[model samples]
Target: MTKAHHIIIVGGGAAGLELATKLGNKLGKKKLAEITLIDSSRTHIWKPLLHEVAAGTLDSSEDQLEYLAQAQWNNFRYRLGRVIGLDRESKELLLEPTLNDEGEEIIPERRFSYDTLVFAVGSLSNDFGIPGVKDHCLFLDSTEQAERFQKNLLNRMLKAHSQSKPIEQGQLHVAIVGAGATGVELAAQLHHVTRLVSAYGLDSIDPAEDIKLHVIEAGPHILPALPQRLSDAAMRELHRLGVTVHLNQRVVEINAAGIVAASGVIIPAAIKVWAAGIKAPEFLKDIAGLETNRINQLVVKRNLQSTRDESIFAIGDCAACPMDDQGNNVPPRAQAAHQQAMTLSRTLVRRLKGEPPLDYTYRDFGSLVAMGHYTTVGNLMGGLAGSMMVSGYIARFVYLTLYKMHQAALYGWPRAILISLLHFLRKGIDPQVKLH
Candidate 1:
């Protein structure tokens, strides 16, 4: 039999998994193409929810999707390994050997040939060469990191509650750098979770008094990328929740004890989180001679094809795609990634029939920052009606629908509804927050 057209997608992130599922359903199900997805990890979790995972508001163990099971159901093959090298000339990519916790190799180094390749390898927190930040600060880029933060948070809380001594200045203080959506929402979530923790038998530690959440932002306003109106609203909510917001404070260094600001301000913190900025992985820079941007993102054309090679395409945060002619690129957001996945799925299907590709256009549904169960705030961009600021239950409902939409895209509406129900049922029996 003639060999099927092999399509390989690297990175089992929001964009990569969605694209893989769609293409697998359209082509792989019919044996028209062989679909394979490669990732360093075996499970996938929505990137935006990492904050909740870190704060213990969301249990990642129940939410994370197993790539192997997903691949089996979606008619795609899942390979667990990191892409270390790419050879455009040979139409092949090399994966490093997969290793276990003890450093024993599981899968040997392998190379896979692809007739078409798509890169959706997401971005990571960029420290910008900040001194001691990497060594002292925790990041919420992955589930592993989030879980680590959660465990550390629980242990610290337990220790604080068990001790008869007074809480030290930095004992229960959490210093979060960057007041973007992640930092702001995390501050709010952690604040709410602290109250829950205190209520759940940790009464010795006062949520408002002992659990201090500090947000340090170099920008003049929180959520600098967002409108000033939304940022102001979020700030008000955060302040009401007793989160200390330090604006225009540039962090010069981070140490085991705390963060030092350029303005001679030092914030003592037992746990520090860095959510300052993001950049595509360093390895993507000019990989296989592909054009890359300053942030190491693959420079892709309007149709999402690499500038240097047509057979290779990139989407999601890894692809520096143009938004318009004004020298602007699409922002790295979940909505942008979702749109790219939808557009790329169509483009690939059309390519099978020798048809022209479809271009990806970002749709601004606005941004929502969910602050645990306290409240959700955001701006709603209605194309013709203009932007409207929303908060409270309406905004919370909209914020939740975004996640529901993602679930529907993956499992269809029925299964997504069932999954939602299962989560609801699980919440009744399980603690609101992860205890151990």
Candidate 2:
């Protein structure tokens, strides 16, 4: 009997999970190939929604998908562990021993052999070795981090509300060290949630006067990767909403009190969130001697295969794929990852049949920024409508559809539809914002 082709996918991010589900249904269900997904976390949550999670505007527990449940339903095997090392010659991936919260080992160190290995481990916040950032500031890289920020925010608000004296200047301020989509959207989300907090019986605190939101950007403009017009619009909205935008300000250091800028401007904040930049996990740099970029992202060909190994592939923020001859690489985005996952799924299937791989060309459907209920803004690329800027309800609807698209990929249309309906119904019965 022919040995079943084994495909191992490391990391259960958007791209990794979708690829595993597709390949599992297409091959694993038929016994043509064995599919396994490995992730350090037991559940998966879309990374884009993390800002809302951090702001306490969205409850993560209600939205998370359990890895074990998804794997069993989709015909794939799920392993919980972090990849520590790789052996290219032996085609084995080494995993660190699983540990519980008390630091006791649950699963011993393990290794899995694979005919094909795909890396989708995703990215982490890039602190650039700035002083006090790693220890003093908070990050939104994972659900636990986001929830920690939310808990801290709640405790701070509760203390301020219960105290007799008036809140001090900058005592309730939030310093977000980045004006990228995450930072900007998080500022807006927090602004919206602060108002809701007062309505929910934290009436002693004035949301507009006590809660100050600061966005510090090293670049000249917010949303630097997007169009200038969109950036200008977002800037106008932020200013109107009382959010302070500090442009061209490089952060020199972060302390428990606030952030110090190289421009000699000091902003005092009780909470600081670092959303500046991203880099792939450190282990990826020169892992198994595979080519990688400065950010530790594995350099890949147009086909999403690593430059040095045909049996190895990468997607999402962990892969540096060239977009043009001028040396422009594909920008790390959810859309790009979704597209890559779809393309790689087909490529893997063809590989099983001894066929040539399909090349992937990123189609920029557009970019959308949802800032709570204030509004959504984005540009639609290509298509009959051509390039156009949109906002208001139309833009918000499209922005939500993006999440639906991601859900459709994982759970199919029927289940995705039911999930959406359940979410809507749950909102009516539950608190609009997460209080605990």
Candidate 3:
């Protein structure tokens, strides 16, 4: 009797979940391969939607896909643990003990052996060792964190509305550190949704005038990674919406009530979110002798395999795969991960047949920044678009389509369509923002 190949995947983000589902449906269903997915969390939510989750514009529960449910529906076995160590020699991956809310260990440390291993553990915000950041700021790195921010925001809104005194300066101020897509989108969502919440019987608080948003970017402008044109458009929209843009101001320290800029400006804020940068979880740094970059991302060859092991592969933001001779690794974006997942899905099937894995070269289709219901701006690359700039409704439609594509990957087109319909219906039945 031949031994069934065991494939183990760590993490449950966009790349990890999609790859597991694909292999599980394709290989596990036939009993040719045993597929297992391990993630620290029991549920998976699209990372890009985290800003909406944080701003209370979207209820995370409505969108979260439970891993156990997904595993049962597909053929993959799901494990509730986080990979902490990897033994390449024994082909065993070590998992840290699972802890409950009270900090009691539920599941003890465990290890799983695999014929093939994949790491898509994703990333966390890089605080850059800034003092007080870890203790004071909320991050949108996970669903729980985003929901925490939402609840806190709701509490503040309710308190301000029910109180007799007028809202004071910085009482409702939100200081978002970083002008990247996450920071910018969050500012827009919070502004739009907070106002909507105020209208829903919290009429004592005027959303238009009560809330103050301060976006602090260390760079010269917002959306520093995107095209300047798109950045300018987004900047204009943010200003039009009354958002305060603080460019080239570096936050040196975060305190209980505010942050101090490098220029010694004290910005008072009720809430502070660090969305500046990302680095892979620290555990990835040289784990089991695997090569990694400065950001702790596993270094990969052109084929997306770890530099030290052919049996292991890395993808998404966790892998430092080079894009070209320009010393540019693939940008950590959802689109790049989406494309890489598709390519690697095919490559894995080929590998099972003793075929060589294919090399990856990223295709930069475009980038889009959605500013809530106001508008969207981005540029399209290649194929008839040729640097064509798109804005307003066209860009917004495209932005919505991106999420639809991710949904299709996980649930297939038929179910994705049904999900979309349900969300549309929900708009009429429920409030646009998460109030409670």
Candidate 4:
């Protein structure tokens, strides 16, 4: 029997998992190709939901998807390791040693060869060499980090509630850098959940008086990437939520005490969060001679293959695939990732069948920003009707549909429907916010 072509997908993120599932069903099930997915994480959680996890609004245990189980159901193999280096010439990858909590080696350094390699490693929070940001500020880039923030936030809340002393200047303050979607959404979520946590018998810390939330943005306005009208709407909503939105305030430095803005204002914060810009992993810049942008994102052609090699492809936040010659590239949105995954699934299938790969054209389905449980605001891209801004319940429904769409992609319609029902049932059975 002829050996099946090996297709190794690294990352297991939204793009990687979706691609693996589609291709696994299309090719692996038919014994056409051997599909394998690798990642440093044992489970996968949708990145957009990280804010919910950090705010204690969503429990990670309830939402995280285990890689081994998903692979078994989807007809792919799973490998737990981080790809440290790439050897394009030999079609091989080097994985770093995995260690346990005691610093003992759990998995030794290893190498894996592939016939076709797909990179979906995703991006991380870029500190831009900022002093003190790394040690002092919390990041929401991964589940572990989000959980750490969640636990710390809970502890601080408990301490403040139990104390007979008045809250210190920075004790109940939260300064969030970057007013992007993640930062903005998190600011709103923290406001809501903290108030809930306080209302649920933690009366010492007054949610309305003692607690403070600051959204520090360097840009002229929050949601700089979105339309000015939408940004204005979001700001209005945020203001009503009692959040202090600091506009045009560039963070010069961050410490345990607070953040110092370029304007020379010190915003004291007990818990600091950095949700600023993102860049691909540090090692990807010149990995195996692959072209990379200043942010270290792998540069790829329109077909989503690396500029230097066709056998390798990249998608999601890690790949810099141009949408046009004018230096425009696909936006790092979940929608774009989903579309790229669908396109690449077809691309890989066609390649195995000796057909030309199709070019990926990102369809802008607009964007949505949810303001916790209150409402959601965004513009929906209607094919011919141009773009129209949506808010309130309609927009909130659409915002939720995005995640439902993702669930449908991964688990199909039946399981997705059941999951939705379970979520509804959970509303009555579980606490509105995770207390522990």
Q: Model 2 reaches what TM-score against the true structure?
A: 0.99
Question: What value does the lDDT take at residue 34 in candidate 2?
Answer: 98
* Residues forming the 10-long window of minimal summed lDDT in candidate 2: 364-373
lDDT against true structure, model 2: 0.94
For model 3, where is the 10-residue window of minimal lDDT?
A: 379-388
Task: Give the per-residue lDDT of model 2 (tens digit) for 323-386.
Answer: 8889988898999989999999999999999997888898998888887789988888987988
Model 1, 291-401: lDDT tens per residue?
Answer: 998899999998999999989999999999999999899999998898999999999999999998898888899999997788898999987879999999999989989
Across 1-436, the per-residue lDDT of candidate 4 in tens digits comes to 8889999999999899999999889999999999999999999999999999999999998888899998999999999999999888888999999998899999999999899999999999999888989999999999999999999999999998888888887798999999999999999999999989998999878888888999999989999999998899999999999999999998989988999998998999999999899999998988888899999999999999999988999999999999977989888889988999999999999999889888999888888999998878899887788999999999988888989889898899999999889989998999999999
> Best-fitting candidate, measured by lDDT?
2
lDDT, each prediction: 0.92, 0.94, 0.91, 0.92
What lDDT would candidate 4 get against the real structure? 0.92
Off by over 4 Å in 1: none
Clashes of 2: 0
| Candidate 3 lDDT, 169-190, residue by residue in tens | 7888899999999999999988
lDDT value, residue 236 of candidate 3? 96
| Deviating ranges (above 4 Å) for candidate 3 | none
Instruction: Give model 3's TM-score versus the native structure.
Output: 0.98
